[model samples]
Target: MKYNNPVIKGFHPDPSVCKVGEDFYLVTSSFEYFPGIPIFHSRDLVNWEQIGHVLTRESQLPLKRVHSYTTSQGIYAPTIRHHDGRFYVIAMNVSNHKTFYVWSDQPNGPWSEPIIVEGLAGFDPSLFFDKDGKVYLTAGAFPGFGPEGIIQAELDIESGQLITESKFIWKGTGGSSPEGPHLYKINDWYYLLVAEGGTEYGHMVTVARSKNPYGPFESNPHNPILSNRSTKLPIQATGHADIVQACDGSWWSVFLGFRPVKSTKVHHLGRETNLAPVEWSEDNWPIIGNNGRAEIQHNGKSLPLGEPIPWQGKEEFDDESLTSVWNFYRNPQKGSWSLTIKQGSLTLYGQSSTLNDYESPAFVGRRQQHFNCEISTLMEFSPKEEGEEAGLTVFMNENHHYEVAKTMKQGKSIILFRRCVGSLWKVENETEYDESIVVFTIKATETDFTFSYTKTNGELEVIGSGETSLLSTQVAGGFTGLYFGLYATGNGKVSTSPAHFEYFHYLPGDE
Candidate 1:
């Protein structure tokens, strides 16, 4: 069954779908986004409910190296499967190539602690269970260090242990860097579907088949079964797909692509999810998309009626801990941030002096949905000493971001739009808004971003507004969301005071 609109959207990439009876569960990669690998549940492949996240506790994965100024490493794509009544997920912490697995009895799970698989370095790890109940793991093979192709290894079904040495299966049929393999058994042939083109403009989907799981395979004649190479549209990149048969026996494919916003060609949202249908030809070869190219239109069906989970937006800083919607760029500090409804706002303690610092400064932000949007926050800020500032920001990386901050100059308060230069907060633009309270708003229209600040005296000033075509993962180079957040930082040896943020709202499609 084809969906008029896909069930999954946003930065949800590398979708792995599993069906247990009539219910279906899907998981996607969360690189730097905390609460990694958001798991979604659906009955009709159209409507999806975020059942839970696979990694909630920090102990399951560490972020010391991942959250650093020198490097950006986070968990990459993951594959989820259900075997014998137990649910399993195989994932790779891309910063380090070690693979790990987690298990749960229920799809909406109180999942088990991660059991690190015996392996070195690799990405895009997936698990395959054959008809004989034998398990195998498939991953992207890296060369210069080892092999240059897709590699597979036997896994113990009961212990989730590696049983056989990793072996190379196929080098790809003249395609560069073949990876992202999803193993499937159709009829009597074992099919391996892979994504090639190096996650860039040349990205495509191809397949190979073998009679035995451990032998040489024949490449599909209709290789690159789906791609956007023919389109002149802004959406250039596409690939990294997984397929599954609906309970009604219809086939569907989920993959990743990007929709560029004018000058903001650097997509802060990373790669987005795309959907298409798969049809088998007379010779048993698979053809994807109705016209040999992915449809530009949304193809997911409407979800069945249920008491839907509320659409996520507008976070109240009432609870003592951070909400699920909030995640730190690197590692979070113990008392850097908190939520206190009784205090009437969210309090963020100052940490790093600038955005590029490795210490996870008091930052709480959400995903940018890759379109027009308005994000606003109200705050009462108190600087610890001189040079201290607190404000709202749109962050892509430490070096690439813009913020409106209230800072103490001499004995007076001033507002500024600042960008980061290592430890220094360079004042790109500023205005003399000597007020204790302020309302800051950022309006993003497609690729352009504008900043507005209003003082308590009703004086509204435009601090710094310009085209932000610099927030793309291709440009900024991280697997994190383009963040709109509330943050604070102290200068020297100083006593810190909490910056109270009243509300943070993202009005998507704002005119």
Candidate 2:
């Protein structure tokens, strides 16, 4: 069977996979988002379903605020491994520079609270359980381990402490930031895999092997076995991979890569999760992806393809809480948004904080999954004050964003098209509207994003447009992508009015 490169699309990056019995479970990094570490379940290597998140409680993952200087810095690379009868996940929070691990009985879980690991001035931590029941923790070099290289320490899993001495293993084949290490005992040999070249366009996966778990490991003859750097491949920045052997004894890898827009190095959809087959036959050394490169389409063996998961393009706000697809910035304040107050409509109360504020604003959104997609929403709001505005926004961060809103200007309701690009903040256009409710639409393409609204006569009228390049990672300098948001804010003062969002529609170009 054939499957697309990004089996799981959008901002789900730094994918790590593990298999238990007939099922394969995957986990990815969620930076600055409320519930961190999204976990997925797939029977076959192709079809995947989002089971739940590993960090559901704020106590486990406290994101008070994001680095204003950095874009995506909450949760970093996570490695999920299944041992004994429980599932374990170990990852780091770059915001605090701390590594922690969690475990649960079920894949979709109310997992245990975090167990913070001490003294690992590094990131991207992984757990390797040997056949003798001993677990080793490996990651990027820290304090005593010296420079950029891989480090290993015997982890006292029961206490989240390193029982054995931490030491430097193999400083990779001279790559910029060697990180994201995963150890696997394959075919009686200990295999150590790590990503290097610093994630950007130069990201790559390299491997080494050792006779023992902690050793003078030998580098693969084919060093940097998997990389798409300096290539014209659609899937660029290919690295940060985890290999999992299927129940059928076949090996596969799940990694993170991004598809740039319009043949350029400007991506706003963020790094997505992709899959590729791993060959491990002749030399004991592994061959990942396709000749050290990932493709847009992969033709591999299928495992009785499971039922596809339903898309959440249309949401009617019928449930008491937001769906799993929905996410909030940082830590949303209580009473900011509600679905119970107004049945079938999402009610958003405008807070004093705006999207530009460092603290959490009254905003809720989902990742802009597709480069070419249409987004539409119906909202009823009458701003009592000038700063009180509510509508749809294409958000990357506080500094880089574009919004088409319904706001009060000079005692009259008006439509607004605003863009925030770095230091420049400007309102491109605004028009007077007599109605309390208006339907807003945003159509996105590879080059630009066009804004539109419904007229009083039910006709669609174009508002304004923004360049998609302005929001790309190259221009904006962030680790994340865009989010289509439903928001209400008072700029700096609390609003007396509320905004009612009736429904939301997100249609991919193909859909």
Tens-digit per-residue lDDT, 442-496, candidate 2: 9999889999999657988898999999999888886787899999998887788
Cα lDDT over the full model 1: 0.74
Q: Tell me the spans in candidate 1 whose CA falls farther than 4 Å from its real position.
A: 1-7, 66-71, 262-266, 298-310, 319-323, 341-344, 420-426, 491-495
For model 1, residues 1-511, the per-residue Cα lDDT tens digits are 3443234545777788888888878898877656677898877665677777888777766665643543456677789998888999888876555688899998777788888887633568888889898888888787674767788889885676779888888877777888788898888999898898877678888989999886688998878887887566555567888887777677877788776665444555657676677789888878777645776664543324344456667766665666555666655677777675236588777875456665557677776764688888889886647777888888877766778888877866688887653344567886666567899999887667889888788877888875556666675665555777788877543336678898888777831
* lDDT for position 47 in model 1: 67
Q: Which 10 consecutive residues of model 1 have the lowest summed lDDT? A: 298-307
Q: Write down the RMSD of all candidates, one decimal each.
A: 3.0, 1.6
Candidate with maximal lDDT? 2
TM-scores of all candidate predictions against the true structure: 0.91, 0.97
Model 2: clashing residue pairs? Answer: none
